[model samples]
Target: MNTKKQILALVAFSSLFISCTKNDIDIVPQNYTIPDTYTFDRNSTTSVDYSGQSSRISMLQEMGDYYKTQATAGNEVNETVLNNMYSNSGNPFSSTDLNTSGKQLKDKTAASTDYFTLLYGGGSTVEQASVRTFFQTQFTQGNNASLGNNAAVGVAGKYLDGTSTRLFAANGLEPQQVVLKGMMGASFMDQIANNYLSVNKLDAGTNVIDNTNKVVEAGKNYTTMEHNWDEAYGYIYGGDIASTNSFKFWSSYINQVNNDTDFNTLKAAIDLAFRKGRAAIVANDYTTRDAQIAIIKEKLALVPAVRAVFYLQEGKAKLITDNGAKAFHALSEGYGFIMSLRYTNKPGTNNPYFTKTEVDTMLNSLISGPNGLWDIDNISPKLDAISAQIATKFGFTVAQAATVN
Candidate 1:
């Protein structure tokens, strides 16, 4: 045989030998095929489902919409209502599906095994409750500010930047931006990188066996392992696949940063990684599956790190121009992005780029003075320093991530 023919024959013989020898797991041969799209089938039926993740994404979308309207309508935000919606209790949503979905953004916020358990002191209910309560408090303060005219030093109210009006707390942080951004990290990013993709969830008890045997869960189309992977994927690419309208939180921000030429292909890279990982799971190619997981975690984590620097840079330039409204809006976003860094997975490790303590200290420096963000004299240097640290950890420079849009 010629050299090419001999090589092909050897590969075929090797695949057959490996397939026959493998007993504990159903390992696909080197020639195993992976689908171009995220679709899998068993017995001629579709086997992918991530409805629960989709519901929670929608819940956050609805919650954000409701919060934004409160100040504009001259209405006081209700803490009880916000809490109910967050916990998915008391039928707070207008959508009947969400009211009955039994899924809330609360259980998932900072709920990842890696970071959540550590930050909450080994899953302490007290710490979790405090975090929820703090969110409600901030929402109330920002919404209540709408009852007055524009905000001033040590005041909470709306501020007009150009033609747009934004509400802020007494210290200059916009509650909407801060809370939403923080959740993007604490809930979505944490769950994706630190929870579902982690071995704690993927390779947990019986996951390998269930995946290898294609053992579908009771009344479910996919196996538990497959479902867990789908849930992670759903958090970002949920809702309508055709429209960006369905994008919220992490989904929205990923696309936002992808617009920059430096990271223009990020969306495609993440999508391919998710698709390949899912396909690898089906093919029983654990090696490929794990490799894809690393890709997904590293790339997805970069979203927040890059944005944290981007927003801080934007806010810093506005501060130099003495534009309070724009500066505060951008910085509020920066605060949330920084808050998210604690949830990021630092490839091949169970730790994040920044610990919760590091993130909190960085956050404190931004809103340090009596007037917090209004303490303009003390803010610029802090923004620069924070941006540098975040960039350094992620192996990127401040100038690269903080590129102007």
Candidate 2:
């Protein structure tokens, strides 16, 4: 056995000598204490570093804001510019740090080992190209606004909303919502639940040895393992230790879900798991570290699942009232959230709650008709079935997730 396996075996053997409670079953080794917060240091210098993740988050913020600008009158989304931003090439971002950060969203979407590797097996290379298809469709459909056709079955243009307008494609789907919320799953959530948090990245090669020895990389403050863990946390919290403001993408939806009284405890629970897991890594308590990983996976998975149902409920109610603009907007968001479901971690398993095929099927069911949302006069039955499926997998009732603004 290797050093990590041997040490874990010894720890397991030693556990028989101590009586432990359920809460403390994975006892910390003696002489090392876990910090109350996510602070870790050696020689009095802090070792936390997730600057790479911070850069990507900021990149998405700039990119999403730029996409939203295309919705305005007489503005068009330049496909090449958006593509450049997605790849972070040709200095697409206005921020100097982001331009030089060398991080790009195009490479990260649906790129996690647990999601992409399992879903695509060895076919991950082609999957990257396939994922960028969303960008092409977003710009293609969004640019349709300049055509001045009122959005309908095969027409793409403005959807009027109480004197204002939101751009919609021929199928009543907002182009930006599809790409933005799709990235919430394909990039942010996938990286956290599947890529950085997975053992493939966390304990790969000498990561455990390096982290356990406090052997910081040359010219860097943190060990490889420490950096990997923080990267996962950064995706959700955006490197903001307080996690209170400036929320974007997945963090924005997480905050949205947390605001609902039915699911108010989610943010705190997820934040605590991240903090405790980082502390456990510092203490060399791999058992506790792994346990916290499970908690993070399971909790993070629910954010997408609950939000998918919530948006669907919102769309169904608005559609019932014959509000086309509001209904399409809600349903478009629901569509993106459902697309996100394939990226969720199912706890103790590398698989997501739903497969890519399953998510695609659900998405197709939503907009299967020629008219899409425009044709669906009564969408409650379809919405309820999709919501119930999502809620059932997460062990919550659709009614529970649907009871909010």
Candidate 3:
């Protein structure tokens, strides 16, 4: 019995030693040579087409412009045009019949096609009803001429008193316009910068591995890495990929910046990064893929940051010149851009470049003063502070961003 016990103990020790040795010796060698190019099947059924979203934005813009023009002319608000903009039934924007047929149809009883209403409620039935009620109130208020000159205009950014009211200020620009534009940067641009293209999602375990091996998952048409890259591309390109002009969505803003010599280099780099990232995905070169994604995030983030600072400075300068309307316009845009900073991607960290609290603090500073932008006191200090916060978060000096024409 003692000899048997001794034999068991010896076997246990031998097993432990073998396990340790195996663990110590096990090493999966990594392939250092990443191919510069690879042929890949680019066609994939897993991609989401954002053409609907793009079309919706364009329709909203057209509707907003029409309302603006009507209000500016002080003409009797046209109910037909208003109804066609967004309605409980037969909304022209999302109607496939109207879009495909190219036929002008009015009040076709097609069901409510309100995009904002749908988005605001997250497509909830209860929330949609509430949104419809809110729209009704706004529409009713718009039709009332006694309320104010701008009351009939449901468009955002139009000021009734030309400067004091929230709904429509004296600038003839609806606050809604500012809200929508800010949403474009915050939601759409940020989705691409911080969400879809983010390393966390793109480089998740087995994703890079699957991508490298061109392993298409069951029921998926594309490899994991290929699908991820395409998803990021969808946010910006939507169905616009076929077009040679890749600068359609957020790239449009970058195009404006490109006009300025200081930002032209970045504008070029932005397009190049996206192209290289897509190519790297095809090549299964993760190092190049990651580098390009970083470039895209940093450069795209700079657009809002640079614009926020630029508009803040412009607002201050306009205030100095006593151009209150123009000052407010610029400040409003700056405020929107500031809010977008919370969506900037910070690689290796779950947090964005700025937090929501930080964004609110900066926004509050701009609108909290006794006279706000109209206080007549130099706002350079306040603008400088905001600029510094952005600069610090993004690893740039305020001076560099401010001086970037």
Candidate 4:
């Protein structure tokens, strides 16, 4: 029983005592999990079952509606950078078509420079990180996982082998994939929506169809579908075989609805087929830039998070006149749904991250970094080329391409 022996004994006793005390049960009740005050009807918008109607088209349409609502809200957002995002003062369209008494009509902060005001004429301040955080959360947070899953966003995020022409040998994807990603995919969304919409109203015998994928009729004799219809023959209209996978041209499919025996059945069938079909295609093709963006109609539909923060950034720009507000707003979700609605990535880099170039140019074709496209000069100019790459890759206009730098 020397000092060392006594210390060891004391240590053993302490360990035993703590172990015994650790087992004491404290049964605290579990905390409550409350639902969000605002949430997109996931049940209504997303597919729980990949069964019949549970498809990508339905998902996109639902998400599209969500974006449309957000766009409406975003249009109303009037911060410094986007001070005029929702001005009713001069634009007759805003006065008559786009506004409601109490509701906010979200519009993209499209202008190079403009602004939106706070409620009751309150002014806006410019903060970059703050806006980016708010906007990113709006898209990535509790809204809908479908809207922000790693599945599509990260499907094929890797450096592309630097080439002169982003050619079409990805195999059967050859030339088509490029078109889908750059040309068709960019315009495909609205094009497909309108195509389906055209066929959506056709009657079979004694049935009527509505926007929702619902029907109220029966069938008779339907006609064969024709994808070569005048409406289905262009960049946005043309439904290129997105991948080696099964591709359905909803434009043609919807047009064939009249050929179906039951108008209601075809109506339901076509509506579900096209809207959900496109969505499904987009969902499946997320690995490719074109298809991924095609399904990502968030920008066109107008996400409020994107718009709000975008305007806030615009406000900063107005106050500072340095584009700091614009750049800062680019990062926020609630401030500007840029994260949710748009892809910011560009081409020619060793990274898969988005660039402001992509966000700036959606459909206008200006500078195509055609694989071995734009030649990079000095390091700074090469970085500027990333913006050009994005604009060209996504089919943006020359003007937009100029703006990206």
- Most lDDT-accurate candidate: 1
Candidate 4 regions off by >4 Å? 1-177, 183-187, 197-374, 378-405
Model 1 residue 404 distance off true place after TM-score fit, in angstroms: 5.3
What local lDDT does model 4 show for residue 237? 21
Off by over 4 Å in 3: 1-53, 56-67, 73-174, 203-224, 237-249, 376-380, 395-405
Between candidates 3 and 4, the one scoring higher on lDDT is: 3
lDDT of 2 by residue, 1-405 (tens): 899999999898788645443234334557666566667776898888778888888887776677665555446767677788888899999988888887898888878876577553222656666777876668677777545677666678876666556778887888778888888788888889888998777877767766767788899888888889988988877735354566767777778888889889988888788888888877777788788999988888888888889889988888878657668888888898887787777777677789777887899888887778777764667888899998998998888888645
lDDT against the true structure, per candidate, is: 0.81, 0.78, 0.55, 0.25
The TM-score, computed over Cα atoms with residue i paired to residue i, of candidate 2 is 0.87
Per-candidate TM-scores read 0.88, 0.87, 0.63, 0.20
lDDT of 1 by residue, 1-405 (tens): 999999999999889866652133657767766677778787889887888888888887777776677756656667668778889999999999999987899888867766666442233456556666767787687657777767888888887655446788898998888778888877888889888887667877778877888898998789988989998988887765554365667777788878888888888888888888888888888878888988988888889999999999899999889757668989999998898887788777677778767988999999999999888888889999999998888888889888736
Among all windows of 10 consecutive residues in model 1, the one with the lowest summed lDDT is 118-127
Superposed by TM-score, candidate 4 places the C-alpha of residue 98 at a distance from the truth, in angstroms, of 42
lDDT of 3 by residue, 1-405 (tens): 699999999999899866542123323334433324322343733232333345544543554555455555555445455555544235544446435543221111111221122221122345335433533344333444323443222222334345234334332223434544555554455557654576656766667666656677677567666665655555455524445764454556666656666677886677677667766665655567778888887787788887788777777777778555556667777776886676566555544567656777997787665545554464668887888777777666665555555
Q: Write the per-residue lDDT of candidate 4 for residues 145-166, one digit (tens) a residue.
A: 2222221111211111122111
lDDT of 4 at 232: 22
Q: Which candidate, 2 or 3, would have the higher lDDT against the true structure?
A: 2
Ranking by lDDT: 1, 2, 3, 4
For candidate 3, the lDDT comes to 0.55
